[model samples]
Target: MNKRSLRTTLIAIGIPTVYAVVLRLLFGIESWANLFSVMTVTFLFCLPTIVGALTVYLSDASKARKTSYRIIAPWIPVFLFFVITLALALEGWACWLMILPVFLIAASLGGLLGGYLKARNMNNKLSISTLVLLPLLLSPLESMIESLPGTYKAYTYIDIDAPADKIWRNVTRVMEIPEAEDTGYLTRTLGFPRPVKAELNYEGVGAYRKAIFTNGLVFHETVTEYQDLQKMVFNIKAHPHEIPSTTLDEHVVIGGDYFDVLSGTYELEKLPNGIHRLHLYSYFKMNTTFNFYAGLWGKWIMKDIQNNILKIEKQRSESM
Candidate 1:
């Protein structure tokens, strides 16, 4: 590539980094990491890349240099992703890394879209208009995205070598989960509570149980359906302050204002032999502008929690 093209690429790459710093300064570090915040930041980053690619093609650069520039365009935003994430981490904002993939994907896609539009000989006036209207468009688009109703479920099942009856006994009231039994990379990093134990006050429908977690977070579970060894349904009642956060924003916690652990169920199906299929299901709510992305992380974290509990129950029943 020619020196001119190289300079353009470097400037394009630096745009997103500078944008991120300015965003942090404007919104503060904590507010800069939400779904809307990340999306807006990514959109702003894409504008420069789009404008940069257009500038390269419209400039006095040679045909070969233009071709080379288009080829390397996508990486500009990706490079920005790494640089911006590193900056956030250095500032003690590593929690933003959880959505690193989102930012990277957004950058890459935006760069490609920008290049595609430029290649179509789209009027520069239209491109400039898009940049002007894009921010205005995002506010309502985000609301529409968040307003879209969604009921998401996470299912995890394990085949235990124990009888359904034994598994039921263990499932109804899980014993103390030792600290060693609670080692999950994501959960540990997010500071999610580990289940200590569970207690039931009654036996049939309308019964109440409390599953305690680390850091004083407690879930009040009220049984809705009771079918012995077959199905158990319960609703989740939780308080936010009891949960901890890895960031200054407590909204990252599951029970926070924007996210919730709605309800859960456990089902046991006796197989042809002595084994049982223990199914753990969770239904959650995400009242956020980025439910799609939030739901992804929510399912992962819940799946980890479910598997941990099931693993212990499986071990306990097998040992019995």
Candidate 2:
């Protein structure tokens, strides 16, 4: 690549990288899973196209628009992958592998659009207009997405050297976990409430239960399915203002309009000889353009919480 071409490439990559760093590191933006971040992703998608077209416009004015597309098409993914790695490392985010495909697809579409605009000699006008209006367009899109319906699940299991009956007691009601026992740094850092103790108010279907989390957040659940010593399920009740934002930014709450935990399950299965298997499951949904990306962090956070509870249960069950 010529010096000018190389300069265009570096500037295109650097601009987005700096924006991301500011959003995530300085401003404490949690994840690329939010609608605002998705808007940023859309910006990144269109950025390379503009850069490519501008390169042609400046350097080779008569170059075919297809040539610009061809030169920049492959670099879109390369540049994005670099940004993803940098973000993941700096922010300790999740699911880069899965989010990569979404980024690639968005970049491809944006690059094609940019190429078409360049072909029609409208690249500059369109690029400028899009940059100005994208944030505005994304606001309503985020709202619409937040209102859509989606349900997802995460599962975690452990084998205990004890009987099913022994494990059931701990599963039904987790005792007061000591504050030290709660390894909450992960959730706390992300502004998610830490898991505390859970209390069950009666037995059988329609029974009431409360799962108390840190930050004064509690989940109210109604027993939907109950079986003695084998399985238990609870349908989550709508709990308003349950998710708190521990960050300076007010827009990153994982609960409320952005995401919700719908239900949860705990099960114990009898295994061969002197052992039992315990399973924990959580069902949730996120209303965001980047649901796929958001789901990754959701699963990790849920899985860690599940493992914490199961570890306590395993220790208690074996000793009993």
Candidate 3:
């Protein structure tokens, strides 16, 4: 790249990133100005869009000969911002992974807007300044609007070749799961604690069960309804205070302010030809301004975890 291009690149990427860092710190402060929050739509969506617009506007890359280049170029700086924040520990891996898609898409859309403004020879200074300050200007108003909590369910099942009794045994009390048997792709990729074992004192309603996982995470469950070899329902609780802080990002932590698991159920239906289908389902809650998006991820992670357990149960029951 030429010196002029290099200078433009540095200015475009640097200014927006520095602005983002400052905003992040300011929003994180617990003072009376708590309305400026990182969890709001302004920060998640609007900030990145502004970053992309600034990048395209400053770089003048919007005038590129290739339309594709103009569209895709803004993402480079936004991705760099992600890398820099991750390296600085300003953001956690799980949070970044969840927000990466949103950032990239929003940035691209902003790039398109920036290109349009440039093509029309609009007042670059005025437009860029407004875009840069948009998130800060809107965050306070957005924060005043409370986020409504939403409840969602994740259901998964597997057909076991074993008898209903054997499936029930495994479902009621999951044995110590070896690492090789764990098949939870999403949770594992996000560094979530792996399930180790579950201990149930006895069968029937009112019984208590402790589901233990790595990194000192535990789910306390109380059986609310029970039917021998047919179905079992339990209310699940994971106390955030009791969990190790390092186990999960605070934003995505189970039973934390933003997300939680409420209850779980297991059902065994005897299919034809002596096969038993085991169904595992759980209810989770997401209390975020972006529950529509966050809830999708919440369901995916829950399904992955539940499916992994069901797979293990199926393997063990069939082997017996």
Worst 10 residues of 3 by lDDT: 61-70
Among the numbered candidates, top lDDT falls to: 3
Q: What is the per-residue lDDT of model 2 for residues 1-320, given as tens digits with 9 covering 90 to 100? A: 88986776556555544443343442234453444453333433433334333333333334325654535553443455456645455422323333455545554555455455556654577564675355446543553543445678989999999877778878887788786766655555554556678899876898888888777678788889999888899987545554444321233344566567788898888888877888889898876555566677677777877887788889888886
Count clashing residue pairs in model 2.
0
TM-score of each: 0.72, 0.61, 0.96
Question: Can you write out model 1's per-residue Cα lDDT over 1-320, one digit (the tens) per residue?
Answer: 88987776566556545554454454334553443343343343443444344333333334314554555554455556456645565323333555555555554555455455555655856874575346445543553444443568989999999877899999999788889877566777765667899998876799998999877778889999999989999999887766554422454565766668889999998887788999999998876555677778878878888988888899899997
Error of 2 at 63 (Å): 21
| Native-structure RMSD, model 2 | 7.1
State candidate 3's TM-score: 0.96
How does model 2 score by TM-score?
A: 0.61
User: Would you list the C-alpha lDDT of every candidate in the order shown?
Assistant: 0.66, 0.61, 0.86
lDDT of 1: 0.66
RMSD of each: 4.9, 7.1, 1.5
How many steric overlaps does candidate 3 have?
0
